[model samples]
Target: MRELVFALDYDPGWNTLADTLADFPDARVRSLSLHATADSLWRVDHATGSPDALSAIEDAFLTADYYADCLATEPCGADSETEVLDETDDTLVLYTYWQRTPVCTSIPHLALEHLGDGLLFETQHEQRRHTWRIIHPEDADIHGFFDALHAELSADVNVEIIRLTGLSATNTATFSAEEGTLTREQREALTAAVHHGFYNTPREIDLGELAEELGLPRSTLTYRVRRAEAEIIKQYMNHDPVSPSDPTS
Candidate 1:
């Protein structure tokens, strides 16, 4: 199967939110999740990048022109049921439900329905991050999918393909980090790593701070991170063993 991740810098004509997020100098919408079912579209936004960013979020949602009214609003933790931790200063967890119909139909949404049950979609709002995982079948055509999307969305958006890769079953296991198999500790460790920008170049949080935030000893946290990293790499590499002497591997 193959997955394609892309970002769309939408045209102003199609932007449902009236306020420009760029206006806020310090605020940024991070790790946004958009779930559009048959009846409603909900956006769960995680605020980071600045202490006052949460206020920016409040302003955006309050001034958005898409919905007639707010369906619901609530505090949501990042990828778990637990509340946002105080140590993580930038994590402003929030979810807002929009009762009105979507102003514009998303190309990914149509593509998933067209492919039936084989494809999965994960998307974001302000960042407009989109990931599509397609289980390849005899009839599937990657080229055709891109062509169709171009035809449908080109008028209102510039679609840029960021990355595409093929993953066999073994490799995809690590990519997904199967929650069913990972212990709670492992999940939290991995999730925190992502949230803290550990994967980015020039690293945001050091090992010590990450350990402090998770309230674990540095050695224990290192062990958990390595185990989770190993689990993922093992799947990607088809269970090939890392060199015993090189922990960085």
Candidate 2:
């Protein structure tokens, strides 16, 4: 299969970040900042939300210095260890670093701003229109991260694969590859159809033959084979990276 690479200029990983912080009402999350680590997990310092803090989130655009750090070769997990990482500042935004396995490495930086101690963030994700996300974690103003990412995605947009990850009770999308979700039975039926030349250029094989050999009732066999063909076609049509423009009068 052909491969295509696209970026998530705006990603919404922090949707629950703010809600997560609200859990602690009394002790406002403070000293919040984002830092990349050699391992994973971003160190959020002074994770709190105060009035004066929330005002500092919007800053920087057009130019952002990409910070380089040691890259981790292994995948990160919820149990991944994070220590009091480094600290730095880029003009307006301050960095309170820590290591937490990033959900996806492809996601670049976050828009940050100070909100007392709480932080507001934004990320760029790609689908059709670049999906932009805004987040207010415990404490910080992350407006810039989102801006740069959005800009990058729009700078020169192209078709990109959207990996379905992180599922919750209400969340839906879960396909990694279109075929990733196929069941064993589905795979078997599809394989049989393909092998029997059912999908061969022309009239191909008859349903009765497939049903007899595959040990399925004719109706059942027809449904399964049709379904399998549809899935393959759907995936092919959906996964194509470069596509021809639609002709319209």
For 1-249, candidate 2 gives per-residue lDDT tens digits of 111122221122222222232332332223343333334434343322333322222111111121111112233332322233332232122343334445423232333222122223333211212222223332232233323333333222221222222223333322323646566776887688779865543324555677798789876765564455445434543442322462310
Relative to the true structure, how large is the alpha-carbon lDDT of every model?
0.48, 0.35
Best by lDDT: 1
Writing each residue's lDDT as its tens digit, candidate 1 over 124-189 gives 444322223334332344445555565555333444444444554344322343446667788788
Stretches of candidate 1 exceeding 4 Å from the true structure:
11-19, 24-27, 30-34, 67-89, 98-104, 124-148, 152-156, 169-249
The CA lDDT at 161 in model 2 is: 27
Quick one: best TM-score, which candidate?
1
TM-score of each: 0.44, 0.25
